[model samples]
Target: MTIPTPPPGPEPLRETIARHGLDARKALGQHFLLDPGITARIAGLAGDLAGQNVVEVGPGPGGLTRALLDSEAGRVVAVEVDTRAVAIITELASRAGGRLEVIEADAMRLDLTTLCPAPRQVIANLPYNVGTPLLVGWLRQAAAWTRLTLMFQQEVAERICAAPGSAHYGRLGVLAQWTCRCGVLMHIPPGAFSPPPKVHSAVVGLIPHAHQPDAALFRAMEQVTAAAFGQRRKMLRGALKPLGGESLLAEAGIDGSRRAETLDIAEFDRLARLHMRRAAA
Candidate 1:
């Protein structure tokens, strides 16, 4: 399908920033992505947004927001906590002829499932300070989103897509992989941002599983993973001692002597399932 050209913005991004004195605040973990080519490329990673309702978080200066509008998405909801950005994008929304909706609020407190119509997809350059927490929250309700194309610090991205036995693997990897199919889409240099972050950044894509574990099982998985990885260096027998220790490992068919990092997603799932069953009994 042919993609529509992005509507022209009210003004150049730089001028808009200068006019509004929109400096990137350190407290908010703000790193503005100003390059049109990069923002467009980030938007492209979301893929065929034609009829999709897209939600973007931390849309500073509306750089990525403009690109989403260009994709001809059925609707583009830009949620920004900063009122300055909200004012800037509100102007862009006016020029967008109703395709754009700008909401001023903290993304962390908002429930995305009730925010838009499906098939819903979240595409954003998430703020560094709250990126991981927001991602963990989304993983809990992974089925609500059709896709998640998010930009996070390179290290955090590795943790999300890391495999068992790897140094980066831990609770985040277990929870993320269990809920969705995740992978790093691209690596972006620190220089890509207006005020570059000290470390590099990478984009990650997550598509929820067709058959997700129920709430009880999910909570069980959280408990098991937290306990196991809380002391990753300890053997399962010791790490999971509070949860029945060796007995729990034996019931789940996992070796008591193995470290948490040595166990894969399926093994973790087994442990969580058994833990849930035992709790119910």
Candidate 2:
């Protein structure tokens, strides 16, 4: 199908909702982002979507779908768990000129790298309930995408981009920062949705590292971070006891007295590497 050229004038999303009898379904964790301007801004942040394969998650009622198609994006493969929403987005695909493919499945279950052409990038306003789990799954396969521009509750966004020693810093911050450069792009007020969520939302982007820390080291870092931040208030010597306490810190040349939040990415990597060498031995 040829990509549908958006006709001149407004797309009339609200009118479409009224005509189609669409309402956000809480069962699906569906809160449709309703602002056209916000949609346009999100698509633009993807950085030259033209000819790039883009993946969008939870394309409820096609708000962001229309924006992505209007932009220069070459192709968009949207995965939606809600079957009802999938039907609506399929119509969006036709209007999108064959450039949009609607996949009726959970984003967490799909293999993004295998679904689209290379140079893939993910851009979406994720369903709130499944956002963090989906993100952690994607991070596990970070090499699959060139970049990702995603919208999440502001709290999750903070966790992803949090600085070391900050209150928000934890396993999430360590895992995200370990492989990618991430930052918040925009703050979306709660009022911008059909059924506005309780908390505000934000857009954040991730650009994966060109060369990651060693694979074994990276895994060990994740393990160490999980143990440390899983008990954040405890001293590192106590928190990281699962990975061998003072001996692990000593081998990594780090001070065991420090708390988890105080260690930066380099120190995390150092611990990971130390764990790796010991495992190899």
- Can you give the TM-score per candidate against the true fold? 0.95, 0.92
* lDDT string, candidate 1, 1-281, tens digits: 33233346456788888777789999999999988998899889988898899999999998999889888689999999998888888878889889899889999999987889889999999999999999988888888899999999999999999999999999999999999999999999999897999999999999999988888999999999999999988999999999889999998888999999999999999999999999999
List the global CA lDDT of all models: 0.91, 0.85
Q: In model 1, what is the error at residue 265, expressed in angstroms?
A: 0.5
Q: Stretches of candidate 1 above 4 Å error?
A: 1-10
Question: What is the TM-score (0 to 1) of candidate 2?
Answer: 0.92
